[model samples]
Target: MSSNSPFPSLLDGTLSLPVTPLIRGALEHSKKITSPTTVNHCIRSAYFAILLSQKLARKDAEPLDAELIVYSVIMHDLGWAVDKSLLSKDKRFEVDSANMARTYLQSTKESGVWDKHRVQLAWDAIALHATPSFSQHKEPEVMLASMGILADFQGHFIANQLITVDEFKAIVGAFPRLGFKDQFIGIMCGLCAYKPETTYDNFVGEWGCEFGLDGKGTGKEEYAKNRLASTFPRTLLPTLIALAEYENEAPAE
Candidate 1:
């Protein structure tokens, strides 16, 4: 679609552009169901993954599957859609999005292009993208996908090492952030409201405890109790309280 190069020098001619019907279908599906902010984020994440792979010279060790990468990244956040029917309460948002991506892959006209192994790779990437320790050790597809996501959200310090500032501007210029930080948190909070257990033991749970889910507290007391119980000395209680208060007042941006 957009002819913008993800990385001016690294990914200029190395990576294959997604142009097949299945890939196009995935992009269209993502745009229809997800917000523009999310769709842009997914595109940026895919590009970032490719750039990271090129930077690490992992193309030969772990070949890039252009179609699979596009499909996986584009659909990774679909579970966070405002349409509750698209998500599953029985699973975490990550698993829900992964399952949806898998199902879409299985039903595509070019489904044969991706075998069971490839499908599983994409699934694992989406499901474990939030867990660096786990995803970083998996297959190239999984690891790179997660890295791309991390780079987009939390890798600002390492951006210079990964790609040039001009390249970064090009990527974000094409797909603007558009208040992604606050919007993403709001989406996670909504997920917590729908399925509280899904957020437990994850970063979303911490956000819930800090911000309160849908303006209603979700396990705030339990989270506080756990923090208090885990602390070694009661003497640190006042300091912890002060820090928590400051954090609560701090801007999420």
Candidate 2:
């Protein structure tokens, strides 16, 4: 077992959340350079990403993928570990996270079997997961990348299992601030692909092959309304958690 942080453990065909050493280190590093509020947001984003991935996987009848989902979510924001300058919308964060993932995987070759393809898939997924708009082709990594991105954005609407409309608005407010509106919108389209009730298998399949899913339902308007009504709330939870943290840390006179 690596001592850096506890790795997520699988039991009864489900994964239990494990402390991510990489994420913890990133959090520590981020705190030094990022404001307390931003650091809290980062942590909340990661947590909700993990939770949302599990929910989506279960909803799609692909519970076996939870551990992979957890791993990806924990490290998704870890590019912030290396350089604060990479904190914004720059592509450096993607490259930095990808390189860090490569190093981590290479360093732990004995933990499990690692095929070149699987490793590459993991690397690519982490690298491109944050940028949905740029991925116009379908691939295995693309599915995982979509999963990661969807989980990240949807986490903004959920709180303690209850979805808040106000928090959803706040999340929308913060969307353009992150320079990720296109990516978020792209994931929404992906989620509604094939049909409104599309399963996880469809999600995985459509990931690397195309820009948008089958576009089921009446049209874009109805589809958008449906997606906003069902899923985005679960996604919003993490953002709310981070906001709560910000409130807790407010300066007192």
Candidate 3:
């Protein structure tokens, strides 16, 4: 990957992918469960995170483990897998994904390579990848991983000038988006329909607010419109929807 490194990257020249065996395994597992869109997003997140980290130029920062970033981010959305079994009924999608990544690291054939600390680090990166307020302040690995993911979703808002437009195009060129927004929203909506409780606190909850299968209002749009009309005074729309749903669901006297 680097000038002095012996590990040959699957990518060559410029920004490269240090293709380790574990990374390969992680990619295969991701492909088996989730759609190719997610798989590309995960891989892109690693490159974006690494490049952004380098741009940050933290003096005396510990060298980032690229394999760890790739392996961890690659499976960050295993909870969104088409396999269904990985999608838990009770836990948030992030939590489910984190647990799966942890298990993979623990079960790898490379003994002594992934100690408990490393495994936990991977868990933190995937689990907290969506929680910028907290993850942005945690370890470099955690923050970088989260930022990388946020960049992929939010783009310039999160990356600022760190990742230039050309750089972004190159990354997206290598890994085509393929209607990521629609696909991602569809999956979250499915989550809301299947396990609304798990989406109650996150952005997923917003899409969940729309799906009628949750037994909320007459329908999603009317319910959301009603909530928008009333709850505008108290809280944010997504938070309001989640709170209203929970309040309505409680057993009444």
Candidate 4:
């Protein structure tokens, strides 16, 4: 790479990463809004996603969009901002984050650089990044974002193989974990404390229930024991029963 080249080549120059003014701006914007831990987490997730994208591209013979992946990852946690004033009272954090990303990306819509489709992709990627079972089935960009986030938290299974152990170490060295487990859980608990209803359907609800849901230093260890969520072994029966009446009254197709 020339001295004038703006793009970054990481992992000992083996991987070339795209860095546009928008990408740089987004990263700066992320640092400005969220906690340092969350910012580092997003950066780490972006690298993981890009690495995973490269491996998946080689396997499927389809190249993934690195810039879009970075864009999606960097802003994926805007909903976890420490300042409650920046968040909505009722929307899930994932939705809140997705909306923020969409609004930011939309500014470039008229320029045709960030067109409707690309913006939508970024939105979907951010919104679904927490839902692996679902996101993995979506578009490549969406799946990569989710996979990358999971990789950071769970140590990508391919760490030693497709992504070298040394490379992973480099990523960690550049963007330290910063006690992510406790810090991330604390952020989620804060959300649950503020908006329990918004988290009722997601994985975070369990976290809320297991940890301190009241947000007043109280752990609701037994809170979910007798609740329908835990006692009921059956899954869709409640939903099916709720809609069964409507189905019985409808005309046959």
Candidate 5:
């Protein structure tokens, strides 16, 4: 991609982090999709995944294997890029995504830098990120899968931010599971104000918050905290914490 090209600009909107051929391929694939909505969502999700991964890396005490993890998450939806129908929670799609990552990586100049084992890991992570049920591998695979799921979730949340207040209200009206008002309150309580919530404290204290969600409320504050608190088998809290800090630093551009 050209440095001044829109593709690079689009990619540049992502977190400043390492990317692999697998990730690049996913973006290229996203460009080819026939539907504007799907293309937009996938593109945003790709950027979201990169942002979340970089945020997580920042908060880590030890250096993270971020390139590998972020690359895996970016490629998680490759199947959807190849065929819109592959967006479903089906085995074929999962395999397609995985194979796409492997094929793309191998076809690129970076292929030599990554060994066979690393490529295998990438394949496994990209493939199962969308289908955790199919994940039997551990470590990077699990991490990648969790990142992908959370990326998708956070992408939707970010996408909502782009909508008008009325449009957002309509979205929440259609999807009550989002708990719009509650989530908004939660975000306000945590992020902007950086204050604790008595309600979240009470709920999490009684229920014992998983990650940071128990008493975190359900607003943007909670969403931020939830992003940090979520983990494997639940949500990736560490990753969210990193992302929260990164979001805090994002330039207004």
Candidate 6:
């Protein structure tokens, strides 16, 4: 396979892809388990990530790791598969997907190509893709992966800021949306149905609020109840004498 292959032009330059056996395997695996809509979404997100990297001039820093970006983006949503066995009840869907990707990356015959640190980067990118506050400040691979997902889901706002209309059209043309919104929502709801606790305080919580699950109340309501129950009342504090005594014994900051 070629070390680098030309991708569709965006932002007046052709994107160079690092073709590798791992990347091909990731794409194939994702396609087999995920719906066509999801596969297309993953591919588009990879393109968006590349475009965002170019827009931010990250390509100049150290020659962005195209293989890593593709691996991270393509495998980011593997937890949303219809096969519930792929998900975890104890962790959020993102964690499950990240773990799954990490295992796959480590299992490859040429796994030596990716060290522990590189695998960790991919894990972080996949796990934090939905969190802008975290991913936005992380490494290029993490940040770009998040940006790509955001741009695809909310293209109305992000498309104009990063790429031209022609570029946006090209990406969508390559991978059509094909009712991804409803399908994605259904996937989240199904996950919550199986593991409602995973939705608390996360983006999936918003989905739970929007679409009521079978037995579980709106996630927002449950989250609010938990927050209310966990807090301590200010009125229960000790009097001034006790406060002063504690303050005197406390070490200086």
Which stretches in model 5 have alpha-carbon errors above 4 Å?
1-14, 17-26, 33-36, 54-62, 81-91, 110-112, 132-137, 140-145, 154-253
**TM-score, cand. 1:** 0.78
Candidate 4, clashing residue pairs? none
Q: Every model's Cα RMSD, please?
A: 11.1, 21.0, 7.5, 4.0, 18.2, 5.1
Ranking by lDDT: 4, 6, 3, 1, 5, 2
Worst 10 residues of 1 by lDDT: 2-11
Tens digits of per-residue lDDT for model 6, 171-244: 88867999998888777766666787677557775675666553235454664454344334423344554578
Off by over 4 Å in 1: 1-16, 58-62, 215-253
Which of the two, 1 or 6, has more lDDT? 6
Give TM per candidate.
0.78, 0.40, 0.79, 0.82, 0.44, 0.80
- Rank candidates, TM-score, best first: 4, 6, 3, 1, 5, 2
Model 2 CA deviation exceeding 4 Å by range: 1-43, 58-63, 82-91, 109-111, 134-253
The deviation in Å at residue 109 for candidate 2 is 5.7
In candidate 2, what are the lDDT values of residues 1-253, reduced to their tens digit?
A: 2444433322232433445444454445455543444344444443344434454444445334334434444455455442444433423445556766666666753325657876676676667775565442534334544443553456444335432454334333433234344443443354444334432223332331333353232255554444444454556786787788767675977
Candidate 4 yields a Cα-based lDDT of 0.78
> Given candidate 3, what's the lDDT at residue 245?
73
lDDT of 5 by residue, 13-49 (tens): 4334344555565556556642344444444444444
Cα lDDT tens digits, model 3, 137-205, are 888888888888888986655545677777777787778898898788778777767776666567776
Candidate 4, 89-188: lDDT as tens digits: 9899999999987877767532237767878889999999999888989888898999888888876454455666787788888788999988877877
lDDT tens readout by residue for model 1, 95-201: 98899888888888865677779889999999998898999898878888888888788644564567667666767876789889888878876766678767765
